[model samples]
Target: MEYEKLVRGDVELWKRKLMKRSSLLNRTAKKAQTKMNGLIPEKANSVITESIKKMVQGALFGSEYLTKTKAVRAATLEELDKEVKEKLNFYKKAAAVEGAGTGGAGILLGLADFPLLLSIKMKYLFEVAALYGYDTKQYEERLFILYVFQLAFSSDQTRMETMDKIDHWETYKEDAEEIDWRVFQQEYRDYLDLVKLLQLVPGIGAIVGAYANYNLMDQLGETALNAYRLRWFNERENGQKQEKQSGL
Candidate 1:
């Protein structure tokens, strides 16, 4: 009957695994920083400039680890079935103990807060990825959109109280780590409405919505990755533009 104790134990085990993963990530970042310093031309730039670039690179790689972190965090809290419950609840006097109650309150709090956390994670991940010569803006944007969709469906109230107190989607330089969950939800709602127009197609149903949502995400992610591949073209174009301006 004491499901809470069982769940807590499971969570503890999962936490240990997470901690190990985090340790490995930290070690990798440290090694990367070392490598970057060794490779950069020491005399070409000021110490501050070189240090900043290295820090940026470290942050970018750190963000890639966020993807794994998110997946692991979700798997750690999977719904408990009867078999899992039995295995977890080894404590005797099962009927004598009171249920700790549905984690509704906790879930509500997480739903309210997860979008903001996820946004921070995405931006940080993008920063880290960008350092490794990867353009992750599209992936970050798509993930942000997915987080918005999740926030919308997680709560019954269409209007979240948190929206009134916060702002969102400012330039990345302004508040890269902060996101207004309520505003994000409103944006997703608008996006969802636009996709609804596509539902008029003959074979499209609820699946149409699902396909649209994921298709946009896939496209965004692919765009971000593709930008890296086209970097040489971009550099050439920029060079030509600069030359034209100089000639003028």
Candidate 2:
């Protein structure tokens, strides 16, 4: 019970942080990205969008093959949280290593880091879903994973909209259209462009790549954990309400 209370408190605090207004730095960066986006040719934008869609589709299907099924034995939330944290540690190390290896190899290999890192992130999310006792094999669960990914990497305005969908996911999913791949790819690219560009530089690429990937994993891990926490609490509340209604 104490652990539950602590987790609830943490979730509340995370929610507050999530809903906060963007800092001046973030706004400025977004404006620059917008200008850059406008300068890109429409054909190139389309190509990039299609490429990202395929890459993400590949990761989604690939991760499903690798992800474990839901735990057979039920575990307490604290136990699940502990295990998830351990997995997050492993993933952060893995991402850092991958980033450094690619970065140190120069431009061509650095380009390879994009798909590799995306794969690692998606794989970790699949594992997290399983650890939280969800079946990633379900289509809706995989869709939820994408929502979590978008929430973690989008601009403040997009993040706010994504969060609202995540908060009311049960209702939203009933009529949810396929994700806008154009928006998905653009936002994701915009979020990582600066750091990833630094990763392509010759001399300091290794260090930059490692540090950036490690921190990116940290951010994704935290976002995934809290997103699940929100689901956990929501489900519990719904179950309680159902039981009370039945008792009446």
Candidate 3:
């Protein structure tokens, strides 16, 4: 009887120890995850994207100041043009660097839609972050992100509803294949915004951004082929008051 009692006591003690250990482990994991998340560029990304969304929305709705300040408006328009041009150059160079054939360049030429694509990229990034439990100011950003994520994860039958009628998921898949995960990791580490948010979690933000960038281009052509991407881009900018009211 004594032996049985002693055995029972031992079992109880073991159970207590296990409970304590489990509690400690959970605490440690939570702390680590928080620390890691702190390293992501989420804050800066959020701030910059929110600002961009606001600007775009204002331009769309015809803000009084924007209309009144001809110089500011002109500068803003010039900036937009410059951005489109820069993105065009980047796409051309990126395609060249990636060794995309004449066919790829042709597609890009047909799709020369940076105004649309930029707006989409900005809004999509904001939205995807929201879906992943990130916060976004512009509701449109949220919608854009959903579109991209849906496209990214979708099976063929469902995609046609949101994006352009072009069938480029397979092409996106190909471009995604060319990503150097190692280089991406390094670049992710180097990204200042991510460095701040995901300080402990290292490469998560980079992986997300790289994958998004590569895949965004997968379905759309470079500026040479598809200028219609502008509609998608400018749509996000069309709702400034809505963007502000929605926290964007």
Instruction: Report, for all candidates in order, the number of backbone clashes.
Output: 6, 0, 28
Instruction: Tell how far residue 124 is off in model 2, in angstroms.
Output: 0.2
Backbone steric clashes in candidate 1, count: 6
RMSD of model 2, in Å?
Answer: 1.2
- TM-score of candidate 2 relative to the true fold: 0.96
Q: Rank the candidates by TM-score, best first.
A: 2, 1, 3
lDDT, residue 33, candidate 3: 48
Measured by lDDT, the strongest candidate is 2
lDDT of each: 0.35, 0.91, 0.35
Clashing pairs in 1: 59-128, 60-127, 60-128, 60-129, 61-128, 63-125
The positional error of residue 2 in candidate 2, measured at the CA in angstroms, is 0.8
> How much is the lDDT of residue 81 in candidate 3?
40
Which digits, one per residue and each the tens of the lDDT, describe model 3 over residues 1-248? 46435534543453243233235654464456446656758766466455545544543333222222121211232333444445444543443323222213433422332233344434333322322232344344333333443333222223333344222332333333322222222222222232223312333433333333454444332221122233322333456656888994
How does model 3 fare in lDDT? 0.35
**Candidate 1 vs candidate 3, TM-score winner:** 1
